[model samples]
Target: MQEASAINKEHDKPPQITRGFWLTALLILMFIANPLTAFAYFTSPDVIVSVHPKATIGIVYFFGVMSTINFAIAVGIWCWKKWAVYGMYLSVAIAFVINIYLGVGILGALFGLVGGLVIFLTTRNRWQWFN
Candidate 1:
C-alpha cells in the first residue's frame, strides 16, 4: 500500500501552465525593460511613442509601482499563496485595461494581454478554483 501511495503521488495531475512559467516571464520582462528603456532614452526616445506629457505624473507612478508590485505578486503566487493569486488576477486584469486606456505602449500592452490570456486560459474552466 505504501508503494502504491508513492506511485500515485508521482502520477498526480500536472500543473496547468506551472507558476514558474509566469514568474520567469515577469523576470525576463523586468530585465528587458530596464535596458530597453535606457537605450530608448539614449538612442531615440521616438522609437516607441505613447501619449503626451501630463500634469499629474500619476500615470508614470502608477506604471512604475504596478510593475514592481506585479513582480512581487508573481513570485508570491508562484509560491502558492491564495491571496497573491487573487491579487495576480485582479492586478493583471486592471493593469491590462488601464494601460491600454492610459496610453501605455503596444509592447507593454502585449505583455499584459498575454498575461491575461495565460491566467484566463488556465483558470477559466476551473469554476471551483475561484472561490
Candidate 2:
C-alpha cells in the first residue's frame, strides 16, 4: 500500500493556482483595449496621421501590428505563459521609442509605459503560478 501510494503521488498534478482578482482585471482590460486600438489603427490610419503629421503610414501600420501582438500577449498571459510578460515589456519599450520618434516628447513616452509598470506590479507576486 505504501509503495502504491508513493507512485500515485508522483503522478499527481500540482494544485491549480488562481490568477486572483487584480491580475484577472488587468488581463481583461488588456484583452478589450488592445484589440480595439489595433482595429482603430487598421481601419483609420488618418486618425493617428492627423494628430502626428510627422508619422508616416508605415509607422501607423507598425503601431497596428504591435497592438495585435499585444493582444496575443494578453491571451498568452491569460494562459499563464511566462513569455507573455517578457513580450509585454518588449512591446512597451517599442512603443516608447516610437512615441519619442513621433515627437510625443520624453514625458509622454514615459507615460505610455505606465501600463507596463501596472502589469509588472500585478504579476510580480504571481510569478510562481505562471508557467
TM-score of each: 0.50, 0.83
Q: What TM-score does structure 2 among the candidates reach? A: 0.83
What is the C-alpha lDDT profile of model 2 across 1-131, one tens digit per residue? Answer: 99999989988968668887877887898899989999999999998899998898899999999989999999999988989999999999999999999999999999999878987988898899889
Candidate of highest TM-score: 2
Over 4 Å off, model 1: 1-51, 54-56, 103-111, 122-131
Task: Kindly report which residue pairs in candidate 2 clash with one another.
Answer: none
- The 10-residue segment with the lowest total lDDT in model 2: 13-22
Best by lDDT: 2
Least accurate stretch of 10 residues (summed lDDT) in model 1? 47-56
For residues 1-131, what per-residue lDDT tens digits would candidate 1 score against the true structure? 99999989888966464434554575466456635544444444333333444313554555556656666665554555556567767877777777667566767866876765665555444434333
Candidate 1: residue 84 Cα off by (Å): 1.9
lDDT of each: 0.58, 0.91
CA RMSD, predictions in order: 6.3, 4.0
